[model samples]
Target: MARVKKPKAMNAQEKLTFLLSLVPFLIERERVSVAEVAEHFGVDAEQIREAVRLIAVSGVPGETSTYQYEDLFDIAWDDFEDNDQIVLTNQVALDDSPRFSAREAAALIAGLQYLSALPENADRTAVASLMTKLSRGASAQPSQLAVEDTGSDATLALIRQSVTAGTQLEFDYLGARGTRERRRVDPLRVESMDADWYLRGWDHLREAVRTFRLDRISNPRVSEQPISHSAGDVVLPDTLFESSAEDLVVTVEVTNSAAALLADYIPDGAAREQLEGRVRTTVRVSHYHGLKRLMAGMSGVATVVEPAEARRVVAEWAAAGAARYDGDAS
Candidate 1:
């Protein structure tokens, strides 16, 4: 005999959506037959019955796992079991969706604008409809939120089109050294962080998973050939801060406000509180040049806690800046 395959588990989002929808539907019907409701939702009768049972037992979770009876969902058990009809005695009000705050709505609008830059989002009608619906549903006005796209529109559009068609792309990428290199990449996805758009993809030339800043990429061409790599094989780091064995780990004592800029650079298990009411954060950097640039921007508020070399570099950089300022004053 063949073994029966178990159904795939519903994720937290799926379960939440189902429960929310079920409550509003049950409220509308007042007395819904279990079999009919199950059919409508494309679920088995047993599944619907189990869902109802779960709801009946659930309540507003307190500080502990326990819940009070008054807070629990009430169901007419006799009617449900005997007549196969669902009758809710009481339910929490969740029919109307929560409205987005002004900030939240603005964030969504900014994200949508970034997405709109993609050529794969070719259906202008659909995009406009989506934007209108989002703006209309939100508590804030879309006109109030201003989001700028800093990347090359033509290059980004081509990359998006290539990604959608599952094809490879070739582009001239300008490096930090101001030199341009030709690269062929299997496009995966485009992501935005702090308004900077980056394309995370498989670089066929280098044979590694690489991230290319959209602003640095130029003359992008979509290939006729299909993509030769699986997207699943590539995984990008949560933070784009480069990691290397040669990188120096420089610790700094910073105030709460001052530490925000170093959030992405600080490694795990490297942040600790000091007796002087400051956070000691260890950051990894390629060399003194980057650290000098960072410290110069901080205006002497950040103090290097360790590594003699880094300290020396910061002191020298500061002295040079002071000399430059004095010369300008003269």
Candidate 2:
């Protein structure tokens, strides 16, 4: 291979990484603009094709494709100095999220390695096999998972340390009820439940063990706090995963205009039926805030049709709003 003048910046490996990460996305969209690739990846459209070209030829070669064969991709790149286009000859049924996230690759490998390290005596042979697939890219990568990185690493460090030490913790907690107050909590453990991190600890103010979202905590501090109480009393709900049994069950009767927006906002699982003009919809949400906000945003377009408490809550909130600004309550 001769010394090819590389693009202004980006090494072969970097380019390869960028290209592979994108193959899945382009594959999903099936075909995409060269401009989108350039704008998103911060690389030239030509460079992206160079990556696609690499993908086109990547696979085992064979008669059709045996062992070192690279003819699977029929990627055709069209160059227009003013506007460019790219076409994929094949489907992108592959996981490409890792290509976008270099750290995720390491996290991916580390997580697998951690689980794979479990002993055969642990009876996780099946799990071990799945972990291997994860490392090798069994499932496709997803779009970016939203993460709000708090400036303070101390909060994270505190939670991890408290779990390790089995010590209690103290912090001012903001409850899901939108009521803010201070509390001394017994840090039972921390868990990533439902894509959000939560402290599965004993919230003292509530006189009960409640899951507090890690992000909601402020001034998190680990204490020499002694607690003789076992976490046996702080049990998570058994119905936590039962979607059918434990959905919010919100019902909405809406007119034509609002009905269209309802489909975008409320999920089908929560929404019930669609008839000629109006639809009766229901949602099974663990909490009311999400549904409350949805109804609030819908304003006059839709009506909350079920659950007397839900109706009362919305009415109360509306009344509160009316009093706050001395606005029209009628």
Candidate 3:
């Protein structure tokens, strides 16, 4: 016969902490086996049984300095003695505990919905289960919330498939410089910021790690050539946009409300200044070719404050866009 090792003894403080935690655990599950609770807490089954005995007699003293029967915790004695199950029938002062508000639950549910959209989070069952629990547990009814599809599910699915298969991916990518080229890359990691999805991969053409926006990728095809490099094989930059000596440093002034939207564009320890309700900060980009689109996206909330060339590029691009609607009645 094999000898069973006893669990190490816990001191007074440890026992108190265990008892405090055990109350909520039993309350949440309504019923749990002593063996299961012991496994969860990493203790012996006998320890859990002892804690239950302690909890049943513990309670806050009444005004007369006496503990009333109703004021103390109570458990189902029949199940505990027969099946070794723990069930709390009478709880003390826990009904007054704070719970998630309707607004808070709605916000959390919205975030979970966004998480469910990612290709990596393919297990809809877990996310759905959590959302249901939040809805039911909230103090009030949470407002209905939904995440709109980004219309890049197909591209995201393909990239995820390539990454799992350790295969190289081929795609016609429209670069930030407004040039389109075919690229072959070893799929590495897929990430998202705000509403956009990006793929970080080892670019064979550039012989370096490059980040590609999912929306700009077209004609994606998975190649049979096995991935030659993984994320661990390369030193990826903390930021998606890798800085280079040739990167053009342009200063821009943006409204205070929209400054947070430029987090990825701003480099670490970059020069920044606040004047009234606007801020002036330096941002880096591969070239000024992409500056026009950035300025347009801000919709007059941002402006290139310096670098005669960058300002000229944006102005010229805007002028051309306006020319398209020249003399149009509609």
Candidate 4:
């Protein structure tokens, strides 16, 4: 019998509750969807659903018993003549920074401190310095932080422009496999997730909506395609990553010599365990090649026990590696 593994991430309910706590601010300021809120907060779809529940029930008092959704926040569906979905209307803006608790302040400062570990040339140094600027109470200055300006793909800037003017775009895309492809797309909407920029659009070729990493595209021809973007359009979850598969779950047996080293490559691999100097670790990963590289890197530290295919893949790679150095230098 196999042991059930612990989750490395927050589940739906917990995430939803934490997110709902922020709703009063968004509602008071501008409209937003549960998915957008979830994406920004780094939570899951189920979590977003809960946020929607809060949004549905959330409002000041209505004139009648039934509350007006528009009066509370901008909310609606898109593609009624086409699809089933929900969306937020109107351009949203942050009313202001929320009041930070003492702990939140400290954590925020600590985050800026961590960003300072990046290379010196990062443009965000100006932004990171805001930590000290906004946080007057901090005693000392944090180290200089930096990041690369990943080729001005025009994220929030263009998003605002396109959404305002209802423009279209044509661009060359660099895909995940390092292939360059061209896409003449209908620019529907745009949003940022965890600082990464994304463009939500209708890909004519796929006959469905898709998202492209802003930085990965260049010379986007704008509004050339004759496509009308309906109001209240929201990007769906699957379009974000493009892959239709669950994270690979692999269980490995790594006794005395190596159990601790399993973490260097696995998702949130830092989790620890002890079992008679032998540990059984389970890893959740999406990329199979990455897992192969990790197994090869471990050398002899951990032995993969489950998912016969995973072990076979790693063994083949190791065998090929051995053949490369077989009977060579002394």
Candidate ranking under lDDT, highest first, comes to 3, 1, 2, 4
What tens-digit string does per-residue lDDT give for candidate 3 at 110-211? 999877655456588999999998886788999998866665777776777787788999999998767899999997777876557898889999998888
Alpha-carbon error at 148 in model 4, in Å? 7.2
Give per-residue CA lDDT, model 1, range 178-270, as digits (tens).
779999999876776654677877888889878788888888899988888746666667776666797789988877677887877787777
Q: Which residue pairs in candidate 4 collide?
A: 116-145, 122-146, 122-147, 168-222, 168-223, 169-223, 170-221
- For all predicted structures, in order, the TM-scores are 0.53, 0.38, 0.65, 0.34
Instruction: Give the candidate number with the greatest lDDT.
Output: 3
Off by over 4 Å in 2: 1-148, 151-154, 191-195, 230-234, 239-290, 293-303, 306-330
Query: lDDT tens digits, residues 1-330, model 2?
Result: 889665587887976677668866776565577779878887776777566667766643446545332325556644322345666664433422334344464465555544332221134566566544444453444333323345333565676566557777788777666777776777665555434566665666667766677667887677787654446556665332223454476677877766755554465356357767767776555567756766777787777887987888778887887797775533
Which is better, 2 or 3, measured by TM-score? 3
Clashes of each: 0, 23, 0, 7
- TM-score, cand. 1 vs. native: 0.53
Model 3 Cα displacement at 4 (Å)?
A: 16
The count of residue-pair clashes in candidate 4 stands at 7
Which candidate gets the maximum TM-score versus the true structure? 3
Compared with the true structure, what per-residue lDDT tens digits does model 4 show for residues 270-292?
A: 34456676777677655567567
The global C-alpha lDDT for each of the candidates, from Candidate 1 onward, is: 0.77, 0.61, 0.85, 0.58
